[model samples]
Structures are given as structure tokens and as C-alpha cells.
Target: MSDFMTRVLRRETHSPRSGWSVVAAILVALAAIYALLESVLAALGQPAWLVHPLDALTWIADLPGPYPQILLGAAGFLMALVGLIFLGNGLLPGRRPRHVIDNPRVAIVVDDEVIASALAKCARVAAGVTREQVMVVVSARLVQVNVRPTSGIRLSEQKIQAAVESQLADMELDPRPAVTVKLASSGVIGV
Candidate 1:
């Protein structure tokens, strides 16, 4: 039963650009359908109830002589631009769901929110900061920590940075992101 020994593994999937792609595709498709319906209705001598909006579209045909050519040229250019945008989007890689780590047998995939929360907890404990004063953002290449100091309390940037860096180092994140510490100019009123 060599066939029964196969391993089945599934990777997390993400469709970051598919949303915009679908939207652009829908817009193009709707435009084509509208034109087709209008043309069919007009050819068959059907009443203009559903076609009322299409009547407004006659501006393309009614463009005054030279203006018609100019308008059509502009329209063609706009359509081409939209098509190019869609093409670029299709060609580029979308948002990746998870980052690949070093180990081939095992993988570590972490979400931004989770990373931010962990960093916030660490920052609060390490810097003696209140949860309200700590904010974190984890991007692909950076982890930003913004600290709004509590009133009447002074905070040390070095200790916070060291603590955060140590914690991140312990985690052993692949493609480890750089850490940025930003201290707010004014402390919050209450805590």
C-alpha cells in the first residue's frame, strides 16, 4: 500500500488583489452587457423603458463632429488605461497569507494583529506602560511601537527597545522585521 502513505498538507491562502481584480472585471462586464442590451433593444424596436438610461449614452454618437473623434479617443485611452491597470494587478503577487520560515519540516506563520498584541504586552511590562499608552503595528518589514507616556511618569526608550528586541529575537521570526520606537510628544491626560 505505497499509495496509502502519501502526506496531505494544505497551505494558508490569501487573495489580496483578487478583490480589486474582480471589481475591475465586473465594471468591464457590466459595460459590455449594457451596450449589448441597448443595441439589441434598439434593433428589435422595443420600447425604451429599460433602455432609458441607454438613451443618455447617446452623447458618444452625438459628439459634435471633431469633438466625437476627440471624445472617442479619450474614451479609448481611458479603457486602455483601465485594461493596463488590471493587467498589472494580475501580473503582480497579491498579499501573502503567511511568511515562510527557515525550517522545511515545520513552519511558523503569524498574523500582524497577534504580533502587535504580543509586542504591546511586552512593551507594557518592560516599560511599565499602561495598555492605553501602547500601540503597535507589525508590517512585512517593520514593527512600529508608539508609546504615549502616562502623565507623571517618565519612560526610557532604551529599556523598551531592548525588551522588545529581546522578545522578538526569542521568537525567531523568519525574515525578522526591524523594530521602530516612537515616543509621543505629549503624555496622555489620565493614564
Candidate 2:
């Protein structure tokens, strides 16, 4: 329990709440404060500055026929939508930027960019291809490696796949993501 709290307090916490969630909370707090202030001012028979700017609300109330009904229905719908947004934001987990290889015990957190770049470097070195020819994209569960050979060069996909697999094995990611090697249909002219 203490460890979990510590993680939340840390700046680089793994799964913290989104900024919009905090904004929603602040808005609710401000609304509550305004309501309390207005009530106190009305009780004391004092001039409420907050109430003055809100004279437009009286105009809205005086609206004739279906105008008042329509306005209120729209306002209610908007408020309901906002409530739903806030509820969803609070309930849903954030899109974690870093993957947790080992959690709680060792707590190894690695960024997606780091994994992709490392895979790209390893693929380039193993395949003897220039940086432009090899493109690597690393996700939570998959590593896609695309290789494009120069004209007249027939690069073996098996060799490239094995090299990438070896690199992945060496890293030993916790979740153990799959690797895929694809050869471009047409070779590049210069690169």
C-alpha cells in the first residue's frame, strides 16, 4: 500500500491520471465554491457580484414558449455530456508511455522509442543495410522490421528474421513481444 502511494507521488509514475481529469475536478470545485458564496450572500442580504454577471440567467428563465424548454434541454444535454466525459476520464486508465518489464519487484520501465531505436540499430548492424533501408517499429506486443535492399541485391529474409529474433532474445522483454521481418517488394535505387 505504501509502495503504491510512493509510486503515485513520484514524478515519473507509471499509470497516473490524465491532466483533463484534474481539470474536471477543478471545475467542479469552483462551481461548488460559487454556489456556497451565492447562498451566503443571499442569506445576509448583501449585493452579490457573482449574481450580477449571472443576470443573463434571469433572461434565460424569462424565455417564452419552447425557447426556455429548448434552451434548458440543450443545457442539460451539454452538462450530461460533460459529466460522461469526466466519468470516462476518471475510470479509464491512461495510455502508458512506458512498458513495465518487471513490476513491483524490479520495476523495469522502458520507453517505446528506446525499444524501436535499439531494434533498428540491431537490424541495421545484422543485415548490413544502411539506416534508410531498415525501418523498425516496436509496440507493446510486436516488433515490425521492414528491410529494403538496393538494386540487384537479394537480401535473405530468413537471415534478417533470425538476427531480429536473436536481438529480441538478448533483450528478454518481460511480456515477450513477437518479431516480424518483411522484405520490400521492390528494391530501392540508391539506398
Candidate 3:
């Protein structure tokens, strides 16, 4: 089962987009901009002066009657449609189910140089994980750094978690901290 899952998860190394996709994306972006400008003008009860001047210039070309407005409107609409299609494709929901980890908790029992360094850095910046609050315990090859916050700031939880995770990821650590927030006082936490 593990081998089968590994085979299913493996991906081929290749660039994702083709040249045509890039061209299509550019066309779509132009259309979306046109639509947005048109909508804004309509909302503000203002005439589309920018488009009007262009239309006036095209009108002097002496093309078939009413052809200028038709051509310009069609072009704008086509561009907007293409942009919508591209956006829809990019933002559409995925079919695959995400992998959820049951036990994300980290138990550091040993004081290795790498782990200790990470913990110290996390403790220093973390409002919750003070020097005294951090407890380093070791058991065989495992090392756990238990952090307890002295302040009841909620922002500390997210900040400390992100900091610790980012630091560990930078060091190429396999498992990151599963930060648990414990409040010491009640108050509004700023992000």
C-alpha cells in the first residue's frame, strides 16, 4: 500500500505552461481591465471619455456605417470574456483531497545544537516562550522544548508559531513546532 501510494504521488519533472497559455493570459488581462474601467464609469455616472476619444478617432476612418462601435464593443467584450475564463480556470476548486496530519505535536527531549538554537531563537522573540518558560528535556534521541507563555496576548500564538515554523523550515528540519497557546491574563491581542 505504501509503495502504491508513493507511485501515485510521484510527479514528472516538466514546465507547466505552454507559449499559447501565456499569450491567452495576456489577452485576458487586457479584457478584464477594460471591463473594470467600463463598470467603474457606469457606477460613477460618468461617460467613458477614454473609450469615446478612441471611438471618435476610429469613426474618421470612413468604414462601413456603425462598424466602429460594433468592432470596438466586440473587441472589448471578447477580451473580458477571455479574462473571465482564465480567472475561472485558475480559481476553480480542486478535486483532490488534502492530506491531514493527525499528530502535529512536536516533543523535543534532547538538547541538540540545531534544536537548541531553534528553540532559543523561538523563545527570544516569542512573547509566550520566555527564557524561564521554555523547558528543555531529553530522552534517548528525542528532544522536547516545552514553551509556556507569561503574557496573555493572542497575537503571540500566531507570531510565535509562524516564527518557529519558518526558522525550522530554513534549517531544513523535517518536523516543526506545533505551538500550543496558554493565556496568563485576559486582554485583546494585537496582530
Candidate 4:
């Protein structure tokens, strides 16, 4: 299987939630609709107060005419501006690229038996190496392994090198061996 496909299959999927911007846009859309309706009612010769509470309040207060229409137009414009900002943010760069995976940490892609056998042999040949101290991770085309050895079982780089190479060779795969080792937590190992 392709590396991308494998990763997808093994990954945990989650449902996405709409952001606050979506909510804001919906509110703005409602406000714009109210503005359009109020304008239409005014054009049809209906009293503005009949369609808008704010217009009725203005009329009760004996406020000068045209104030309500002006307020509604300003409100509509502001709502539209807010909605545009939300939409722009949702589309702009640095706001989460559509295709890229975020913060990918590990890639697991090796047969378990191969890894187990490799680990077992490495532990057996090296005195301090133990199952618990080893962490085997497989990637698309490579295997990464971390090993921690118990105290007092000193190992040298040459010894570790020779042991791992020998164990991998014993696996009898066509590609022979593909493993590397690094000192993880520290136990004496010759460098």
C-alpha cells in the first residue's frame, strides 16, 4: 500500500466543527435580510414603524424622520463587513492548509514479526539489552528503533554494530538487513 494510504488507514479520524466565523456570518445574513425587508416596506408606503421596532421607538420619541432608515442602512453595512471578514479569514493563508497533515509525529509501516525478531536477537546478543528497553518504530521505507540497556552490562559501539548486523542478516530477507541503533538513555557502550 502507498505510504499516504497506509497512514490514512491507521490514523484516527475526527469530525470537523464549524468555526465561530460561520456563526457570525449566519447572524450577519439574518441582519441583511431584515434590512432588505424594512427597505421594501418603506418603498411600499407602509409606515417604517410597522416593519421595524427601532422605527416605532423613534416615532414615539418624536425623533426627526429618516433616522431609522439611516440606522438600518448603517447596521446592514456593518453586518456585511463583519460577514466578509469572517469569510476572508476562513479562506486566507496560514489558516490551515487543506491538504497538509498537521504535526505528523510517527510513521508505522513494518511487519510486526520482522520488528519482533530483530528486537529479540539484538537483546539476546547484547547483555544489557532487554525487551522493555527497546522501542521499535517502522516508517514507510525505514525502521527506527530505540534501545535502552540495563545498568552494569557495558556495550561498545562495535559490539552493538556487529550484533545488530548479524541478527538482521539471520532474518534471511532478500534485502538482507535494514536497521540502525543509537544509544537512547545511556549505559556504557563503546563509541
Best TM-score goes to which candidate? 2
Lowest summed lDDT across 10 adjacent residues in model 2 is found at 5-14
- Over 4 Å off, model 4: 1-110, 187-191
lDDT of 2 by residue, 1-191 (tens): 25764464343424566578679779889988987887777777788855742564776576654566787789889999988987877786544554545444454667778877888888888777789999988776788999988888788878888888887787767556798999889888873
What's the ranking of the predictions by TM-score, best on top? 2, 1, 4, 3
Task: Per model, state how many residue pairs clash.
Answer: 0, 0, 9, 2
lDDT of candidate 3? 0.50
Model 3, range 1-191, lDDT digits (tens) per residue?
35544333321111133444787878789978887787678678789846643465577575556667888789889989977876765565332211211223432122245466555567557654446555543222233545555444444556655665565555443223343434344443323
TM-score of each model, in listed order: 0.64, 0.66, 0.28, 0.33
Write candidate 4's Cα lDDT for 1-191 as tens digits: 46775446344221123665578678889888878888787788786744565565568587445567788678889989977876766665322111222233643333545555565557545745555666655332334455666666555645666666676555443223366666666653433
How accurate locally, in lDDT, is each candidate?
0.74, 0.75, 0.50, 0.55
Alpha carbon lDDT of residue 7, candidate 4? 48
lDDT of 1 by residue, 153-188 (tens): 888888898889998887776568899888898997
RMSD for each of the candidates: 6.0, 4.9, 15.9, 13.0
Q: Which ranges of candidate 3 are over 4 A from the true structure?
A: 1-113, 136-145, 151-155, 174-191
* lDDT score at residue 34, model 2, on the 0-100 scale: 88
Residue 185 lDDT (model 3):
45
Better of 1 and 2 by TM-score: 2
Instruction: Name the regions of candidate 2 deviating beyond 4 angstroms.
Output: 1-13, 18-21, 46-85, 100-107
